[model samples]
Target: MLKNIKTESFYDLCIEESLFLEENVEESLKYLYEHGYRTIAINQSINDDNLGAQKKSKGSNKKVKNSEVPPPIDLSPLIETVDKLNLRGFQIFNRLTITYSNSETFNKFIKSNHYKKYHLIAIIPTTPEAHNYACSSAVEADIYSYNPENKFTARLTRKMYNKIVQHGYYFELQYSHAIEDSTKRKNLIHVSHMYHSTGKSKNVFFSSGAKNLNLIRNPYDILSLGFLFGLNELQCKSCVQHTPQQVIIHSVGRRHGKALFFVENVEETQENDHNDLSNCEPQKKKIKMIVDADVET
Candidate 1:
């Protein structure tokens, strides 16, 4: 955890705060802060349907083609709100949530510089083809977020899950639905069970995805919900703690262009790695060893 962050277990997952009709982003954030949520990612949703609608509304006959990256929903308003709140040790991140329709959507997405502006990117594969692509190498995203109401269905394979994890993408379960209705709770549990059946619940993260502060659950309360959703005690806790931590680290990697581990702008030293055998070693060292934390650390 960062030095200023006080709440250890809470990462609010990702939410579309910009979509809220009457909620005060600042007040909602302050309420979250009071409840010990130290980090939150504000998501902007994107997909072909919405993207095309904008053009249609503008009366532009230009058919939506490839290499299209939707313009970001400005965060300046929310940022100003944060500044007004005068909160400290709170981490706010801009996130893009892409609902993929095809490889072209993702292909165009990665090529677009707009995505680079976000601290994190999440994807919802609405179709089986998109889901398979996400589990494969066709897309880039930190979190695989699917709402229970979306009723996502696909045959998940253990190998696919492992491959996605290998690429640093983790699965996310949004809890607002489960908190609201019994049917949503049952569906969420079913999804979790399917996820666990294919892959272990090790890196599964839980999110509130709450538009109103009333819908939000405390960090520990989330763990209790996870247990109801079929996670074990450790896995349940990790959903709020370990898994969210991984999401943050993964986001940093994307923002920094490390792709997980590569350090940027590292200068080569003139001296050899070993002191006494300085001359024996090459002038440029193959790698430098130093005391530091892992990319996630």
Candidate 2:
């Protein structure tokens, strides 16, 4: 849908080493960016542990002890790779799972790169502490990908969602299952099945994952995500604009030059249309102070 509409750029979060292995890092990122990919998110995956364990374990009786725990993951490797991403810049950094007790260690890895400037979007489980952490941290986050089948999960998830937004963080929610006739092509809205099944409210507050968005056949489906969040046509157009003009006007004291330009245009047109007709002729410029004041003798 985005391709058909010729959407200029996309923010790709959670890119993997597999992508780099399958295609060379420089080539892959360049190709994607040249073809309208804008941002890349370097995130550690939840399945990394499984993959690493499988790679290390070959013998049947091989067992790892708790005392000999693996060292903390250092993200310096990914940060180095980022330096070579010439075309696709990273807008956000993310950690795939915050479920581990040592997620703070991972957070430390990201914070270590103080020189880097980007939004950190870590995953947060549906827990009170997790919710509080996301709200308090300068880093923003989204709900962790998990089953929301039970009432407890839903309630906690909802609380986390509210907390993230209240703290001025944007979040994304994914559906565990598909809904029938839920996504309409005309408007391209993805209604939440969980919300519908649980008799909860359904709207554009939820966003389907990038994988789901790619499968959509309608152009509107891609754009409706923004529209659902109350973006009108002009605002939407401005969002897509190549270079948007920004203006800062002081409400109390300073006159806005841009506003005055239009105001002057209107006044000039109005004066031309309705002339002062007491003289029944074109008005002359009266130098108010000079002409009205007689020389005192």
Candidate 3:
């Protein structure tokens, strides 16, 4: 039998952090769970300059440390609300999205140990050098995302897209921006076409990136909107389902080592144990069996 498996059909990995800070955020989460979303990631975005400023404010001349990194937002209240509502299997994750233009700052910040506090790490590169670093060297990150509302200075080439996918990183496209404004919608579509033409839409997933409850779209609506971004039906479904699942699995593997196991045919194992008992003598001392240490989260 499979153990510790989650088979949810929908995932939204980019709910903006601002929404969580709002007073009615609990209501927003309830709406998402009711609309078929089982997994959600609260995203907090930070830039290289901001990190530098924070470090300087602390009067630190040495290399940046984990203390300089922003701590994950408190979700205890949200968790309590979930418990009160008894929403089973509703998972929430903390995600960090780093926007970087300087390679040096990005490298130092990416290596900080505090990154382990987040369930997923994403990077947005604004320069050609930083873009190359993200595509080739940012192995610790799970997703590569950019702001669709603003024009990006770095161009995405087919080679860069392939390299990113080959490195096991998923591309995130935010659809809420498309629904919020015409200018953003135009820019999002343009970027989506870039992904289509350059990468054939491989390893691409759609996220809400919604700052408010009204900005969030239903999963089915997102599937329909996928076609406008040059994705076929299967690709659209994978964006909300399979691809996002893979991204979660990838993030888990990145945080914990890539070790997994499953127990199959439980009835057969029980039967074998029963049969072995008939031939074996009872021991006076208990047998201590030590298995390898479980993977730490």
Candidate 4:
């Protein structure tokens, strides 16, 4: 038997790891829920520099184990709190965001089982080669995110954007930094313009990327903010609702094959089979015998 997994209607996919460390994290979640975010992903960012350091410390020849990657934060306690609060259908998913300058190191990280623990995998390529490799190569990832605070070093051409969209990857635009600082807002808009020029803002979605509770905004506000990112009303709406849902579905499919449902085999007991047979009455069949005779003709 196959079944569909239930996902919440609204999502704010990029809540930062710092927010989870706060003393009032539960309160923060409550506020977000109140604001109508039913699903949220806590993002843990890893840089290629850190991976290189670990590789150097362990010797370059040795295969890096799962321990080399930063483990996902324990969300059990937060889940319990949410349960106690009676937040129905609320979902918290773990996300791994790798910012890589080197494609080899990125490949090695993705090859490890540790990276699979996350519900969503996002990559931020710092160099042109890394960016091209990420887009063109058969990398296992769900989202392509960029740092709004920093200027993009990698060239984002039209073909690259098209390839990314064709690969079923969503480009994330974090709104929190835009809300926090003018300089970051400018940089964020510049990046958004790039998306607009290259791809006409296709396959783009909005995430909070919120460091604290204060940075979080309602979905409607995010919809309006989407306009500044070159998204029209319908496209803006999709960024918050339809596109995020598709991103989650894509991540699920990435981890668990392309099938919408998992298959399970159910065995029938002999007694049940006998009972089923007993309910049916047997019918007698009459057969007419045909005699073929090569007559005198």
Ranking by TM-score: 4, 3, 1, 2
lDDT of 1 by residue, 180-270 (tens): 8887777788888888887876468888777667888787787677766778778887787777867876666556544334433334434
Task: List the lowest-lDDT window of 10 residues for candidate 2.
Answer: 244-253
lDDT of each: 0.70, 0.34, 0.79, 0.80
The regions of model 2 sitting more than 4 angstroms off are 1-9, 47-96, 100-121, 126-152, 156-160, 174-221, 224-297
Residue pairs that clash (backbone atoms under 3 angstroms), model 1: none
Q: Which stretches of candidate 1 lie over 4 Å from their true place?
A: 1-9, 19-23, 50-86, 258-297
The alpha-carbon RMSD values of the candidates against the true structure, listed in the order shown, are 7.7, 17.2, 6.6, 12.5
Evaluate residue 8 in candidate 3 and report its C-alpha lDDT on the 0 to 100 scale: 68
Q: Return the TM-score for candidate 3, rounded to 2 decimals.
A: 0.81
Q: Report residue 61 deviation for candidate 4 (angstroms).
A: 5.4
The TM-score values for the models, in the order shown, are 0.76, 0.38, 0.81, 0.82
Q: How close is candidate 1 to the true structure, as a TM-score?
A: 0.76
For candidate 3, lDDT tens digit of each residue in 1-297?
A: 122135366899999888777687778778998888988999988777676677768777454565545888777788788888888778788899988887787767666767778888888888888887787754568899978767866788989888888767999999999988899888889888899999999999999998888988889999999988999999999999999888877776566554453223333356556766897965343333222122222
TM-score of 2: 0.38
Better of 1 and 3 by TM-score: 3
Model 2 alpha-carbon miss at residue 252, Å:
32
Could you give candidate 2's per-residue lDDT for residues 177-258 as a string of tens digits? 2322333321122223333333232211232232222232222333444444345554333332321111001110011111
Error of 2 at 123 (Å): 1.8
| Best-to-worst lDDT order | 4, 3, 1, 2
How close to the true structure is residue 130 of candidate 4, measured as C-alpha lDDT? 85
Error of 2 at 266 (Å): 42
